[model samples]
Target chain A: MQLITVAGPPSSGKTSVILKLIEAMQIAASDVGVVKFDCLTSFDHLRYEERGIRVETGFSGKLCPDHFFVSNIEAAVEWGQNAGFKYLITESAGLCNRCSPYIHGIMAICVIDNLAGINTPRKIGPMLKMADIVVVTKGDIVSQAEREVFAFNIRQVNTAVQVIFVNGINGQGATILASHAAKARSIQTLRDLKLRFTTPAAVCSYCTGEIRIGNEYQMGTMKRMEFKKP
Target chain B: MNDTDILYMVLTVPVGEIMEKHPVCQNFFKNLRIEDIERGLPLHQALEKADPETLSEFGLDRHAIQREFCDFLNVFAGRSDATGPEITSITIIGGHGKAGDPENCQITINRGETISIVGPTGSGKSRLLADIECLANCDTPTGRKVLIDEQNLDDERRIELQGRLVAQLSQNMNFVIDLTVNDFLKMHAGSRHSINIDDTVERCFVCANSLAGEAFGLDTRLTQLSGGQSRALMIADTAFMSTSPIVLIDEIENAGIDRRQAIELLASRDKIVFISTHDPLLALGANRRLIIKNGRISRVITTSEEEKACLSEIERLDARLFQIRKKLRNGEIISRNALG
Candidate 1:
């Protein structure tokens, strides 16, 4: 099955872009399935089910969404294969901008809206840096000059990646994104696959449910801010 | 043969032989409403033999008609690429957008055509022109490749080819050279090895003056030319002196030149003209217009015959505006009725 992963900040139109891509692909609902990974509650699977497409939604709850995504993505791939899906898509809301759930050989997309300021491409961290394609959403809402400037900023962060403009509301550029996404090399399993970037690290005292907010409570993998001397 | 020889031959030869040899000349004849040339009569004789009523009906003089026919031949021959490899079309391969998205657009512009690039400000119109100007082979930031004759040129070939293919008149054009206009034209004509230097100089000078708002003497320094004057000067220079086959003009609408004639002059000389314009007249007048969005060509619209039919009305309106501009320059007060 072709593996496609969509990662972006919240409300950047990742789910909408995925929906448009699925529609543009014109595949049978039974042949494709989506695995939605978000932080808290997500009703996106209902949207997918409403379209008669199979979808599995997993919430990380208090855990980092991307960490949960990386850990269970293999199972998601296995589920998709058992379901006889020709295309398997996984989406992660890269909440912290610290991680993106991309595999070594899969089609990775980072969706960011034009409303996210001109410097957003650089601020999004590896989520923008490691993707094979960066789809800019909400192009219809901005001026042509603003769009050009936004695209220029993305080029500054990652020079090798392809930049595309998509209007998620009307699904204007979905077919093009789908065609690029369809070119993902098929993989039988994610067991031997490697992550494009290591997921956000750190197992601090908060991990063990310490609930303390003191510097003394701060533990593993923590960096303290250094104030200039008075 | 050179243009003069061809012109002489066409004028001296029988109209039947000229038509049979160059079938394309039929278009010129048809446009001028010159029908029913006798089998034995030459083109000069055919026009002379025609009644004055027919010539006046088409609003064409005999000598001007012959010159126009020659101009048509020159443009037709340029499209045929009589000299070397045929650059029949300009193909722009898909390139990524600014946001690292793949721009899945393939645009091919044929020779002897006028195209307009239109979009809102900061839409990368100039950037697209730059891509074509450099003949980018995925090395530019946009990763757009411009192909000539549908083949991508390597870096070495692009470097070697250089400015031989495209002569672009950018928005901010300043001539820093210290030479007089007469000296500059003579120098260019000298470099191009023109057979009739005086004739070319006169043609270029008159063409520039006709296009510009105010006329400047040939002895005027190049740096002393105004924005409109310099723009007009380059338009004339690009038409007469520049050897490049492709021409790119950025924002010519505000250049204060005779827009239609400027385009026609270049196009008639076998130059492929691409103008980045915001004016509806220039855009609609083009054979095709590319809509640029977010630094990529979002769409290409070929000017339909129906769209072309609207141009005459636009041209008329533009002419009215031109008159008002003239009156305003003469310090005439703007009366309410004069707005029409």
Candidate 2:
């Protein structure tokens, strides 16, 4: 089954775009499978199941959802393959800005809305830098100039990627996005695959079940930024 | 290179010849302002004739300059002591079990072969590894004798081979030093006399990221790396920079890195790799596996072609279980089809 990873910041309409993409896929919807990965809680899978679309949700409570997603992604794809799916869509939480979930030799799309600010394209990490296609969502709420500027910002960071204005509300560009995702190469296994970029180093005391909230409470691979003397 | 080689060059080798062979040393000398003055003079002779005022300005005397030059080149120059030994094979002469019943097993593993030690918890799996690590000569509690080249390693040979010839990748790896990943790799590459530190560092970084579940930036502090990240980093470092011909890895199932790829990467590097693991993939992956019972080498089993044929089937089951485990961790409800 061909695999596609969708990542962006929280509340960036990733679920909307995915649902719209599946809607545009039409007959391919029955053969498509999706796994929603979120940090704390996710209720988006219910929407997919309602449309008779195969879906599952994974909640990474304390760890970064992207890390959880990548670590278990191969298994998710294996499940999709076993279920006889044609496409397996993995939607990442992208809670941590630096955590990139894209893998090499796979079709990966970044869902960024025009309302997240034009500078967000450059501010985002490799999630935007290494994407195969940048789907600009929420273009309905912004002016044409803002849409042009957002596309320009995306180009500033990644010039080669195809930027599509996918309005998640009415599914305006979902067909184009779905065709791009459909053109992805069929992945037999993720065993030899490579992540396009590295996720952030994590697992502090809190990650290992630390409950307290203080400097003394913090432990385990903590990052302390070093600043030069003024 | 070793200290003796560098010292020999500094003492007698002509400046022009040294510069031609090691252009890096020229940069070091130029940066330190320790010029090899005469066109035909050796480093020592030129340093002796340096102006006293110039030497003091750089905060050094003739003796210190000569000494500093050796130390600088020692870290930056290529390794010349890497010709210590060509370890073709490692033989483990078995020892007694917990009951001291004179356990008898003689196993000889050749270079580029992978071996795994398997047994129950506290079955002396690690003890057998420790004997190999220290190259035991019936000296340890297990009374196991580990031989290099089928011959017992003497004290002098052991001392010469201690840290440089054997690399032990133990469980519970964490970086204590606070340095960037790039700097850490650079330090290792510098001491190893890597042809290109930048290229080596990049390769190590990419390899580590591939092995690790999570990727870390080159500038990421060593201390901030997760358990998996640090272990993957070390695996990559050992694979690329280590000159050690023999590698001993403790149980690596819980390291969060890809165990199969880790084994493959190390074994492909032309090293005799010995791993102690409880995981079936690792045990079956090895060319031969040692069965430990009650702190003794109970049996030695060479993996047959038939056993090797079952690996792919096992991999399929492993992938299935892997997905189930992911679902279990995600608090998702399992349907009947999850097993399929």
Candidate 3:
């Protein structure tokens, strides 16, 4: 089962988009699983239905939603895989992205409200970097040029990423968004790449040198020629 | 490369030259801005004997060596930044030395993750660690307070902080409540900062052929447990249950239960764990070590990056001590064969 997380700032229409996506998948003859992490209220199935989707909630803990949420997501995905479902969508609680563990083996989609550029970096930069794709919701509110600039800024932080502009309320670009998530064979590649990029450079054992490139012997001076590329 | 190449490298290469030349060998010497190799050659020659990698079969490349040095320096930098009493210098106002002087003694704890305060009877190792602990608690005569991440803890918060934030496992391994194994874990699971008790408890018996809950009955009481069993339970509780950022352990093998459990515990994680002990096995488990003489911390010796760098030395000494100790305990079972 492929796990897809719909994460975004508060009131970014994550729940609305998730329901719309779930409804679209069900209509397309694909069984889907959904899990909403309620950090405040205990998990309630009735509350989930009231919010407009079939789900299980009420897992209690002090841990950030991402930590425990991922576990619950994995368990739900296992069930979905056994039940022959095509996808499982997890809607996370709105919080700063740094507290959460980067989910491995799953696609991360950051849903943003298109009308605002001020909240772009502050609310979304770190989370967008974690995402394989950025979904700009409320596409009808923002002009075509504004959407292009938002996508461009996201590309500056993360060079290679797919950005989908969708209006989930009216079902505009909803099929395209689901298609991109379905095509995300494995998100582990992006996660692993980020780890290598963030980790500090390895220090040289001899002479306590911080060698960035070339072989150790040939690192600094012209005399030494042999240096291994890491 | 194979074992023979590794062996040849160790036998043929001078430690200092290897240390200097191996890590981007050309760049290292080049960055020094030296015209002649002979000018800065002495330091490498002196370090020739100190080359950490000895086995030729290991085939550790220059990159690995450089990585280790960086890790070593980073550990030191972390210790300095934390600047807890365990790594700091301490002064004992009065403690008589058997071989030497008697008053105003200073010792520097300068190695590994632990600062083992050791000396003969009345040598005041306990007094030193106690003073450091007290200092860590902000109990100095100058009324200085210890703040973790700039948050000042009051008396009640300090006690709570001491129990939950900083776990201190003294020589006495006694629990007041006669709690069942499951009940004890359940209680601690609440107190734990962020460690998943379910994951850790399950991890303990992951290797067992049988189920953890079934193999080790959850109803087992603390008092009914054997020395090794109690040590394992407590170690698991301390390491997994408590969320204490800093762990202060006094003489882990003081009563000599099963030290392998404690050794394994120390080997994991990047937490600020400080243990005081004369046991070489426990001391050697540290990444950064400190030698505490009298009330002052003396030399700090940080181990190199090789996994189990201090293992051989500690293991050799421990083996000798264990042999001598084996005579005292009549047919003592060191390792317990269990399903749990």
Candidate 4:
């Protein structure tokens, strides 16, 4: 089964896009499955269930959902395969701005809202730069000029990626998104699946639950941010 | 000779000083100038240079003394090791928590009982865990007083007890120490006074790998471990090596490890396990659950038989999820057959 990872910041219409894509894919008579990964709790799995598609949900609790999603993507694929699905779509709760859940050989889609500031695309880490497709949502809320600027900003970060302006609610651009997911390749081995970007170095003592505040006890790859004197 | 004997001897007096103070060994030291004796030679080395015949004449075997002295120095040079305490019960008395109602809350937890604390975000669940951890007595922000066995715990006693009272396994488990996995486990085992450090460390690694989604080698550096691997290691270590009777976990269900087995492993060890969670599977797994609303203990409910029945269904769903998770990690496709 082909795998498609849909990732973006919270409320970037990831589920809406997936739902519309699933509806479009059903029109073509292709079987689909979904796995939703979230940090706390989620209701997206219910939407897939309502559509009568095979679906599973995982809550990462206090852990990083992106890492959790990557670790469990295989099982999701197997579940889809057992049901004879042609495509398996996975959605990750992109809590960490720097984390990239996309894997090589899969159709990695990064959805961004036009209202999330034009600089958001630039601020996004490998998740945006490495994505095969960048879907700009909430175009209805922004003007034509603002939408163009948002798309332009995304291009500045990833010149090679295909940028699509999608209205997730009305099913606009869902056909193209569905076609890309349908044609995506499945990775044969995890070794073949490479990350497009490097992970941010873990340097915070708080990362290890170290409550003490001081540079002497701080360890790992740490960077100090200097404040400008006013 | 035993380690304690060596410790006693070295700590009591220097070997050169001991020899000098004793009249019986004065002649033996005569061959060595007073200046040489006065110049501090390590006790073990000073004993090494003494003549065997002379030592024998004084009713002391030179080789035996040298071996004993070496053993003593080894013990002296090694880091100190300690064991955890045997905690029977924990009691929490009411104080005004940051978010919880100011009403005093009174609750007591006993050994071998698993309790889950559930609340919305910023509901003071962690504050309660912290109160239990610190054995607090009105000093913390929550104003919650913790008692070990119906009596208020002394702050000094809490400091002296080490990991005997609580061993916390928080959400983030990053290993800052730059050591091999085997070396890290070995060090932990050594500190716990394991009889066979190597064997214990091996057991820990095996147990950790069983819980972790990915299998890691003993040669892997601690710093290189992923979030799931580190959590698995910490769980295994806490279950086997840690002497802490009460295990406070912020959340174990998040990192893609086998959460069910991790909880079962800790619970089976007769520990008082308290987990703060948002998942129903983990919440219902506990014998009792403390519902935290606005930071106070709004209500405590025992797991009803109906809930226990629901747990079986939840377990089935959780098991299916776990199977899919495992297959996914192995680079397998999710087929309909995988649901079975």
Error of 1 at A190 (Å): 1.6
Q: Show where candidate 4 strays beyond 4 Å.
A: A1-230, B1-8, B11-82, B97-100, B162-164, B330-340
Error of 2 at B115 (Å): 0.8
Model 1 C-alpha lDDT per residue in residues A1-230, reported as the tens digit of each score: 98899899988998889888887677888999999998877878888899888999888998887779888999999999999999998888737876778888888999999878755776676688778999998765543324544664565455557677665765655655665777888988878788877776668888778887898888897756679999
Docking class of 3: incorrect
Evaluated at residue B84, the lDDT of candidate 3 is 21
Instruction: Give a tens-digit lDDT track for model 1, residues B209-313.
Output: 999988899999877988788888878877886667788887778777788889888888877889999888889988889888888888889999988999998
Which pairs clash in model 2? Answer: B1-B78, B1-B79, B1-B80
Ten residues in sequence with the least summed lDDT for candidate 1 chain A: A140-149
What digit string (tens of lDDT, one per residue) describes model 4 on residues A1-230? 67788899999999899888777565433477778888887888777777776678888875566657667777777677777777778888746777788876678899888878755786775678679999888765432323444554565455567776566876655654655566788643354466555454554666677888898879876766679999
TM-score of B-chain for each predicted structure, in order: 0.70, 0.77, 0.48, 0.74
lDDT tens readout by residue for model 2, B35-56: 5566377877777676676566
lDDT of each: 0.76, 0.75, 0.48, 0.70
Looking at model 4, residue B120 earns an lDDT score of: 94
Clash pairs (backbone) in predicted model 1: A151-B98, A151-B99, A162-B100, A162-B101, A163-B100, A163-B101, A163-B102, A164-B101
lDDT of 3 by residue, B137-200 (tens): 3232212234444444465544333312334555554543456766655544422212354665
- DockQ for all models: 0.01, 0.01, 0.02, 0.01
Using TM-score, rank the candidates from best to worst. Answer: 2, 1, 4, 3
- Candidate 3 local lDDT, A22-50, one digit each (tens): 54343332466566666666433564467
Query: Which of 2 and 3 is the better model by TM-score?
Result: 2
RMSD of each candidate relative to the true structure: 24.9, 26.3, 26.4, 27.0
Error of 2 at A144 (Å): 56
